[model samples]
Target: MCLRGKQRAGRVQSRVHVDTVDPLSAVSDGVYRLDREWRFTYVNAAAAALLARRVEDMVGQRALDCFPEVAGTVIEAEYRAVFADGRDRVFTYFHAPQGRWFEIRAFADPDGLTAFIRDVDDHHRSDQRRADRVAQLTAVLEALPQATVLLDGDGRIVSANRRWTETGEVIRDAGLRPGVIGDSYLEVLSQHLTAEDRRIIGAGIGGLVTGGPRAADPPFVHDYAHAMGSQRAYFRLQAARVEPSGQVVVTHTDITERVRDQQALAWRAAHDDLTELPNRARLLELVGEALGRDPGRGALLLLGLDGFKAVNDSLGHEVGDELLRQVGARLREQVRPCDVVGRLGGDQFLVLARGCDAAEAAALAFRLRTALTRPFCAEGIPVPLTASIGVAAAQPGGDGVHQLLSDADTAAAAAKGAGRDQVHVFSPGLREAARWRLEVANRLRDGAVDELVVHYQPLVRVDTGEPEGVEALLRWQHPERGLLSPAAFLSVAEETGQLIPITRWLLGETTRQAAEWAAGGLPLRMSVNISARHFSAETLVHDVRVALHDSGLAPENLVLELTETSVAEDPTRAEDQLSLLQNSGVVVAIDDFGTGWSSLAQLLALPIGTLKIDRSLLTAAARLAAGGSGSVLTAIVSLARTIGIRSVAEGVETPAHLQMVREAGCELAQGYLLARPMPAADVPRWASRVRAAGGDSCALALRGRAH
Candidate 1:
């Protein structure tokens, strides 16, 4: 037993009398006693071991002098307090010199103080590590750019970083800056989100809480968009449940730019750069989608602009580009809200109208045509434009997008052929015609002139029935169609811009034939037709010169006949070309005079050598053949005479027509009455027969006049 000074005498007397065991010596904990004089009177084995001393060494030692390491520490202060106040206290302190922690309990009696101490370094180090971990985690959370929030199990916001608070302000309701700490996140969601969105967010958040089977384990993520005031943002939310504590760590990332970039890419892929309209690829895709959803519930109109190339060639491509943009806008105005207008490249556009039948489509096409026909003012120039529309109804039979577009294109070509500014619907006959045209266009482009043949028809002097010259006519000997006239493919040649080459071939072949006729003593002048396109050809004069030189044929023996409208279209250029040809001794005649819109002044200005009266005048004269009122014919003949040019009356099929033309003083007459257009080999025989007959059956009547 340990005692204070007051009990020292009694204890010493008792100790001197009785032999009692010391109970403090048998305890496991460090136990020690201090007297009121600050001296240790008792020391147990555990206490001496903790102090790294023997029990005998510590006994009877002053407490402060025994353990100098405890001086001025919480352990010493608590020990002194216990001694002074007769109380009990427990405290822990770290001993820096020994790198250890001491947990001590001091109990004081009336006379002295008793102390129990143990080493607690492990617990102290563990607490220090925990504090360091908390500091590191806080630093990481504060440094993150993404909005980060930590929530408790009850969905209460435990903590939020600056980024989280700032992002919240951006998306928060006006005038609401509620404190994030201790606020219920679930309540915020319920207040601000729509019903559907709230449900979704609630589900995601709920899955992060409670640690239930349905709760997501970790890395739960989702996307949501929000609009606050004028600001719109898209956020990607990611959450994870903290282990052991059941806390949730949620992060929100602003992905607005990514979303917008994706949308922009999609839009650019589906539109045309020049016209700002849906391009061919996108149009087909949309049409395919519509067909997939509702088969045959739409009609497609394929429109081709007429005279677009002229505008491009005359005004320049920049103006043409502006014109296309304006045309797209105009087409948009003409269509219904649900209809689609798209560019199919280069003067072609397509319209998709849902639930429109053939009749409705036709009406709509006409309206669109009218819309396009209105002059487009571009670059301060007004360009008159027209469109040929091909309408194709979506039949219940289920047409493919490609097939629909192809058929619509076919109909559009037919519209262009039937005369532009017209609308044509797709029909079996139209498809057949389009197929034939496609064949002709392909052949023309490939320069397939093998089927072409030149035939000659004799032009006879009206007074003698003697052949004056032979007009060379183009004939197409189709393997299947036998013989086709110029009407079969002349327009196609003109459209394909192949007429220049065809005309060159005609000039060369006729010159050669005239040379052959001259060699055979037939000596007939060769009249070959020329298309209007030849006048514009820069190489026309060179080609004619080469043909005459190569064939050794006299230029005076060749007459080039063209429609009057050809020259009237561009009088200045036409006059220049005619002067060049006439200066070269090549006769220039208006092939179908009196049938064109050429004025008398224009005709007088032309360097023409002959005026070939069209067959229409002959029909008119035949109607008045009985009265012999050849006034119109006489006026045409007089015009030719006044202009110092020969007059040829064409299409005379009977004696009355011939006699009428003769009375009208026409110098030359040619038609089936003289001879049908024959092969070059047959022309010589026919001219020979006319020369041998001395008088043709009609010539007999002219014999009296000759007499």
Candidate 2:
């Protein structure tokens, strides 16, 4: 018994040393020695600090004295429990004097009871802080934007965020009440509780509950949506299995607004702002869709304006703007209710029809063509317009919309080639041709970087058929595509505005070559065709002067050929440009005459010095299909005579045609009958033929000579 008592005493001493020597003791409670009477006791630094008194004075005082207010009840309980119950007691006591809280433990013994007290203030305060932080975090989770769901062990939802409940109300007319969380996941998303999403979410609860899809596990997120018509709402949902815990906590984030904005952005990107029409991108998409469907049931048409530039240039853009609006109206009228009419960028439009065969599509295109040809009155000006439409019927095959649109585009180009206001169907070959055109166009833009050259066709005097001048015609010596005629690529040049540079080159080169000839005492004239685009170019006048100065060729010896359409394109502007050239001493000759609307009156009004009759009309002169057909020639010839303009008969092939043309009082002739368009080196020899043909003395006057 004595040995055990000594061991207990040593253990007590060690615990006492540990408590007092510990540096945290100053911040802790104290150990106290109590008397048998429970009246006065010893105090430690922490105990004195808690009681708001000195330890020396505190000792010998009753435990209740230091904490009089709380001691009456709290302190007395610890004392009574240890003494009356004959048991150790432990309780929390708040001392008003220091306004601090502590835990007091008392033990009973023969001498009295020793007690250990711990302040426990910081610990309690720290616990309260942690609780506050958790509460704050909970509040934030409640306020998050995504709809969330919590589930119990049975796969029944247990809770949800406010966004979830609110979105439910928007999705349905009634609110998804708070109890909705306890519902099955499938029931919440779909009318059926066994939906796939429910199965997925349930399985997700099954595996790594807080991060993946498995049974009894919660995924990090549950992102899902239900569609209403064309609109769909999305949410991020999270659930945790917390297995034996049996409760799953879910969170939500709503992404409907973002989805809506993305959709709107996509739609706006492919739509035209002005007409709200499907733009090029959307049109291409439509073509794709059409092609993807049964080919025999769908068709597409690509329509492009023919000579619309003339109207836009002459009447101004405001009127042109109105014209476009009217065109849109007409197109809308022309298409069926189910058909789509989209503007595929400037002056290019596309039409798509379902259940229409190739022939019907062609008819539709022709209808549009007819309507467009009808004159329009905008800003008091009669504007005539037409469109070349390319028709492509869907073939039963695997093809993309972009490819089908390209085929349509190729067909449209072919239509334009056939003659404006016409329609052409697509063939497999057209795709390759279109590709070839792209390559050719690129080369043409580089100024024949791949071999663009010009050959001159001689114009001679009538009667004597003397050499008058030569017309410079561009020929593409494409490296791989082989030699190509102007008809094959000139339209591309004009369309891309490459004609300006090409015309400038032709003028300068022809001038230089002609000047060299003159230096060689040839003294021959040279004529270069000027596209309407070139005439409108700002540098046109400068180009003419530069050519003359660079080539040292006399301005009068250089004639500019203006096509009838180009001259009539903007007659006022045409006359203005002609006046500029004439004032610069450059002669102007109207080319491809009589076909355009500008009559003899209009032709005479322009400041032109020469007129080249159309080869078609001259071919008619050669045929003499009848007597009156011959009369038409006499009238045109007499008109040129009366206007005092020099007339050149084009396409004078046969001797009979040449004799007929000379008999018709034609002033000059240019065709194979004299010599075909030839190279510069061949011209000297050809000039020898002209001299032998007596072209030098063929006097040309707009008089009644032989008609």
List lDDT for all candidates, in order.
0.81, 0.73
* Tens-digit lDDT track of model 1 for 615-656: 996787667655765477787788779869999999887767
Pick out the ten consecutive residues of candidate 2 with the lowest summed lDDT.
698-707
| Candidate 2 wrongly placed segments (more than 4 Å) | 1-150, 155-196, 206-218, 226-234, 240-246, 277-297, 305-341, 363-386, 446-450, 480-483, 621-631, 689-707
Where model 1 places Cα greater than 4 Å from the true spot, the runs are 1-164, 173-226, 234-276, 305-330, 343-348, 370-386, 477-484, 624-630, 695-707
Give TM per candidate.
0.73, 0.69
Task: Give the number of the best model, judged by lDDT.
Answer: 1
Position 587, candidate 2: lDDT: 89
Clashes of 2: 27
